[model samples]
Target: MDSTDLAADGWEPILAAALLGAERAPPGGPGPLGDLVTEADPGSALLARLALHGIHHLAGLDLAADAMEPVAVREPAGPECPPAAANRLYALLTGGYATRERLREWFDLAAAAGMRPPAWLHQALLRHTQHLPETVGAVAGAELDWLARACGEDPAAAPAASDWTEGTLAGRRAAFADLRARDPEGARMALEAVFRKEKADIREALVGTLWTGLSEADAPFLEACLDDRAGGVREAAQRLLPRLPRSLYASRMAVRATTALVIESKSRLLRSATHELVVTLPEESPALARDGVEPHAWEQRGGGVRAGLLRDILARAPLHAFAGHPPRLWIELALRSEWAEPIVQGLFSAVAREGDPAWARDIADLLAEAYEGKVSGLRRTNELLGRWVQALDLLPEPEWEARVTELIRARKIEAVLAILAKGPDSFSERFSAALIDWLAFVIRGSDDLRRDLAKPYVIGRLGERLWPGEDIAATAAALAARLPEEEGGDRLRQQVMSLAETLELRVAIRREFQP
Candidate 1:
C-alpha cells in the first residue's frame, strides 16, 4: 500500500515512472505482456499497458449489491391510443369541463377503438374515476396496484368484502349489490347479518340489491322482510317480491285479484255472449298491508291516489288472475269495465313490470290505439297524455319514426318533447334526424312555439339530452339555412343555429375519442 505503489496492478511501477520519472519498473505481467516495453517502442508499450489495466482496476473495485429487487409494474396492454384521443382524455383529467361532462361518450368511443388510457394517464384516472373500477381495469390494467390501494383507503372507490361491514353507506350498498350479483347466498348472509341492527338506509339499500337477479331463491328472505319495521326494507321487499310469480305474497295477491275482479258474460240468442270486466272492491284484510297494499280507502278523492292503492295490489297479481286473454284484449275490455279507472291502471302496471316482449308489444299496440283514438273508453288528462306519449318508447325502434313523425307534423309539441325526454341522451341517428326535422317544423310554425324553442333554457336542455352527432347538426343547420331570411326568421334562425352549434361541439368532443 505504499503511496507510490498506487494500486495500479503490475503497471504501478510503469505509472510511477510516467509521473515521477522513477526507475522504469520491470514488466511483471505474464509472458509477452511482461515484455511489453521492447526496445522497439517503449513509450507506446507503457501507455498501452496503462490503458488495458485501468479497465481491470475498476472492475476489481468492491461495491455493495442492491438490498432488494425493484418492484414489478404491470406491463400495459392494448393498442396504442390515438394521440388526439388520448389528449381529450388528458383534458378531462386535467379539468376540461366540456370533455368531462361527456364521459359516457368518451368511454364508448375509447372502447370501440380498442385502446386504453396510456400509462401516464393512469394515476390521474385513478384519482378522478375513484368509482369506475371497470374503466380503471379496462383502460389501465397496469394501474391495478394503484386501484387496490385506492379501494383500501376509500371505500367509495370500489366494492369490497369489507364494504359490507364498514365504509360509506353507498360503498356498503355497492358491495352488497356486487355480492348479490356474484353470490346471492353470500349477499343474503351479509344482509341477514346486519338486517336487524343496521339503520333504515342501510337496511333499505341491502334489500334493494335484490332488484337485480331477483328469483324464487330470494322469496323466503323477502317474504320475511315484509314484516320488518323499516318502511324502506319492507317497501323494497314489496317491490321485488311481485317480480317473482310463485312467491306466496304473489299467490295471495292473485287470490285477491281474482276475487275482486271477474269477467261476467251475458247470454244472447244465437249469438256469442257479451263479456265485460266486473270489478268489485274486495273487503279489506290485514294481510293486504302485509302484502304491500297501502292502507287507503277504495274511493279516496283526488282521483288517482286511492285507486293507485288498488293498482299497486293488482300490479303484483298473476296475469292469468286478471283474465284468460292477452294483455291487449284484457286491457281493452278493462277500458270498458265499470271500474275502468283502477282496472286499466293495474293492468298497465302488471304488463310494464312483467316486460314480456309479447305483452309489451300488445300493451304498446293498445296504448298506441288509445293515443290515436282508434280505441276509446280510456279517458286521459293532460298529465296522463304526457305519460301515454312517453310509453310509446316501449315499441321497437323501427316503428318509432312513423309514429313520431306523425306527432311532429301534427305539431303535438308537448307529446313530442315527452317522447324525447323519455329517450336516451344519445339518440339513434334516425331519431336525431326526426328531432331535427321537428325543430325545423317548429321554427316555421306559430310565433309562440318559435319563441319557446328560442329560449336559452329550452335549447340548453336539448343540448344536454340530445347526442350531438355531426350529421344531425348539419341537417339542422341546413334547415335553418333553407328558411327565408326575413325578420320573422331572425330569432328562430339564431335559435336553430345555436342548437346546431351545440350539436357540433358535442360531435367534436366525441370525435376526440375516435381515431
Candidate 2:
C-alpha cells in the first residue's frame, strides 16, 4: 500500500498506542526511547492513551491494534510498558483534537483511567478562549470543577507515581498564573473552590493569583478568607478586598473614616482657616461641586495617630471619587509626602498655575534642568512661558530684560522664543533685539529650530528690527552652518538662501563684510 494510504490506515492505532503508552509512564519522567513526557507516569500514560483513542474513534480512525497495548497492560499479566508509550499518548491528545469540549471529554476519560492531564492543558484552554467570551463561559465551569477535584484529591490514594504533592501544587500555581491573564474568572473559580482547604503556603500561592482576575464576584470568596486560619492568607485577602468594585466593606471603611471628626490639634497654624472644605460623594453632590472633590485634606497631618488614621481613610475611599479630582491635588499631596523630582515634573504642567509664584518659580527651575534641548510638548512649554512672561512683566523693564537675558544665557532657547512670541508690544526694543540675538543663539545651538526661524513670521519679526542690511546674511550664514548633513540640512540651507535672496539689499551689504 502507498505511504499515504498506510498513513491513513495506521496513523490512528499508532497514535492511540503512543498516547496510551505515554500516559502510563511517570510525569516529567523519561519515556521509552528517551522521549520526555510532561506528566511522566503509568497513570498519565493510561490517560494519554484513553484520550488518543477517543480522538481517533471520534475522527473515524480505527484504533483496534493501538487499543490492545493499553488493554493488555491493564489486564492481569502484561509486559512492562516502555516510557515512550506515555509520550505517544500526549502527542495524540494535542495533535488532532479540534474542540475544547472534545479535549475535556478526553481529559475526563484520562482522569477516569487514572491519568492526570498536564497543567499546561488547562492554560491552553484558558488562553484560546480569551477573545471568545462565549467559549470561555461554555467551558469555564466544567474546567474549573475538574481542576478543583483533581487538585483536591489525596495524592496518597492515587497510584504511587501519579501522586501529587507540594511540587505538583507549584506546577499548578504556575499554570494558574498564566491562565489568569486570559480567563481570570475561571482561574479564580478554580482556585476559590480549593483555597481554604489547601495548605497555608498553598493558600497564599493561590490568593496571590487572585490579583489577576480580581473583581466584585471574587470579593465574597476573598472576604470569607479574611478570617482564614492562616495569617498570610487573611492578609493577602485583606490587601486585595479593598481594590474590588463598589465593595461595601470598602465603602463602609471610607464612611467611617470621613465621618469621624476628631480635633487633636488646636494650634493656630494647624487650624488656620475654616474653609468648610466640603467632602461630598460624587453621585450625591451637585454638578458644580462634583468636579471639585479634593484629596482628603487630613492627609497633610504628620505621623502618629493622626497620620495613621488619615492613611486608613484615603486607603478605603472610593477610588472613583479621587479619579475625577484634579491631578494638582495629587501633586500637592505628593509634594507633602516628600516625593521625588520626576514625580513632581510628571504632574507639573497639569497643576502648576501661572499665578502661583512659588510654584511657578519652582517649575521654571525644574524645566531649566530637565527640559532644555528635549523636544518637549509645545503646549506645556508655552504655559510655563506664559507664567514666566507674567512674572517678568511684573518686574521693571530693565529687570525684565535682565531676566530674559539670564534665560538666554542659560540656553533656554525654546522658553525664550515662546516668551517673545507671546510677549506684548510694551516690551522694549532692546528686549526685542535681545530676542533676535537669542534666535541667533538658537540657530547656532539647534539645527532644527534654526530652520523654524526661517519661516516668514519669525524671519519678518527678526528682519524688521535687526536692520542694516549687512547683518542679515551673517545671521543666515550662521543658521546655515548649523544644518544637519542630510535632507534636513538641504531643506534648512534652501530656506536660509530663500530668506537671503528675498532680502537682497541686506544680503549684498553683508556679503561685502564677509570677505
Candidate 3:
C-alpha cells in the first residue's frame, strides 16, 4: 500500500489496537500513550488483537495453532505448553510490531498470559542485540536469552552458556556515556560501584564521562578522588577543583597582597609645595618608586646632612595603587619622577577629582610643559579640560571663583579660557563674565602675558561665549584692541564674526580684532 493507504486503512487499525494495549498496561497514567488510547476509543481492543495477529504474519511466523485457539478452548484439554512459549509469542509481537503502541499491546498480552517480562526488559533488549534479523533463529535466540535472564537464572551460568563477550561490556559503556549527558546524576548512580572498582583504563573512561556534570557540589567527591592511585583520575580531579567557587588559592593570594607604606616627598620644592606629603601604600602598591622623607632622617644620617630617600623609594614602588590617593602627593611624586607617563596618568586621575585649584593650576602648567611640542598635546588638553569641567561642577561657586582667580594669578589665561568654554551650561553665565574680565586684564597687563593671551584658543573661547542676548558689541570692541598686526589676527576676527552670526548676536567687529 502507498503511504496514504497505509495511514488511512492499515495503519489506523494498527494504531487503534496499540492505543488500547497502552491503556491496559500497568502504571497507567495521563501520558502520551494514555492520550493515544483515549483518542482511539470504541473498538480499541479489537484493533489491538488484529494488530497482534498482523505483526506475527508480517514477521513470517504463526501463533502455535493450538495456542491460537481461545484460552477457554485449550485450558482444560490441550497439551500443556512451557512458560517459554509465552515469551516466544511476546518476542514475535514486539520484534515485528511497527509502532510503539503495537509493541505496548504485545507487552499487555504477555502480562495477561502470565508471562510478564521483568522490569528491566527494555534495558535487557538494548543490551544483548547487535543486529536484529528476520530469521526465526535470531528471534528465538533473543527471546530465550531474555527469558533465561529474567527467570532469575543467570544466562552466563546456565548449563549451556550463551556466548556473551567483552564486546557486550563495551556496548553498555558507550550507551551509558550517551545517557550520562542526558541525565548526569542518574548515569553516575548507575555506574557508581563500577566507577570505584573498575580497572584503571575503565575508571578513566568513567571519569571522563562525568566532566560535563561537574559543579561545586561535586567538589568534595572530586577532592576525595584527588589521591586516586590512577594518574588519569587524579589529574582530572585536580583540573576541576581549582575552578570551583571560593577556591582556597584565590583567597590566599588576595590576603598576601594587602601591606601599607608611607612615602615622603623628595624634592624641597615639592615638600614645600604642600603642607601634607605622606604617601600611603596598601598591599596593592603601584608599580613605581615609593621613597619620600623618612621621619628619622637625622638619626639615619648620624646627625649629619645626607641625601633624601624620596626619589629612590618612589622609583622602586608600584605606581598603580596611588591612583585614587590625594592629588598633592601624586603631583609631588610625578614632578619628582620628572613627569614619567605612569606618574602623569596617576596625577591626571587624582586631579580629575574635584579639589582645590591652586594646586590644580600649578599641575596644569606642569602638564602643559609635559604636553608641549608633542602630538598628544591636544588629547592631553581635552582630557584635562573634561576633568576640570567635572571638578568645576562639584566645587561650590566660591571655590570655582577662587580657582579662576588662581588661573589669572598664574598668567594661565589660555587654560582658564579653555576651562570656561567647556564648563557645563549651569556655570556658563558666571564663566562668560569671568572670562571677559580676565581677557580685559590680560589685554591691559604686561605685554608678554597679553601676547600669550591673544592665542587662537583664548580668542575662539571668547567669541564662542558672545552669544545672543549678551553685550557682544562691547566684548568685540574690547577684543579688537588686543589683536596683533598679523595673519593670526585676521583669522581671529573672522572666527569672532562667524561665532556672532551663528549665535545671532548683532556685533560689529572693528578692523582691529580682525588683523
Best by TM-score: 1
* Candidate 2 displacement at residue 512 in angstroms: 50
lDDT of 1 by residue, 1-515 (tens): 34443554554555665674324644445655455545446566666666666655555445234313444456656776777777777676675555455565566666666777776676677667643435545656555564444434422346676566687788887877877888877778767866788888888888888886778988999999998888888899988988888888888888888777777778999998877776667555677878878656545652445456667778788775755656776767766665666776676677667755576577667766676667666664564465465456555555555677787777778667556545444456766677777787776787777766665544555665565777777886787677667776587677667667767767776776655
- Tens digits of per-residue lDDT, candidate 2, 131-216, equal 22233233243543444344443222212221222366666566666777678787777676666568898888778778876788
Candidate 1 TM-score over all chains jointly: 0.70
Decide which is better by lDDT, 2 or 3. Answer: 2
TM-scores, each model vs. reference: 0.70, 0.30, 0.29
Residue 393 accuracy (lDDT) in model 3 = 43
Judging by TM-score, tell me the better candidate of 1 and 2. 1
- How high is the lDDT of residue 44 in model 1? 63
lDDT score for residue 106 of model 3: 35
Please give the range of 10 consecutive residues that has the lowest summed lDDT in model 2.
71-80
Q: Which runs in model 3 stand beyond 4 Å of their true positions?
A: 1-327, 350-398, 409-428, 441-451, 463-469, 477-488, 502-515
- Which candidate number would show the highest lDDT if scored against the true structure? 1
For model 1, what is the C-alpha lDDT against the true structure? 0.68
- Model 3 — TM-score against the truth? 0.29
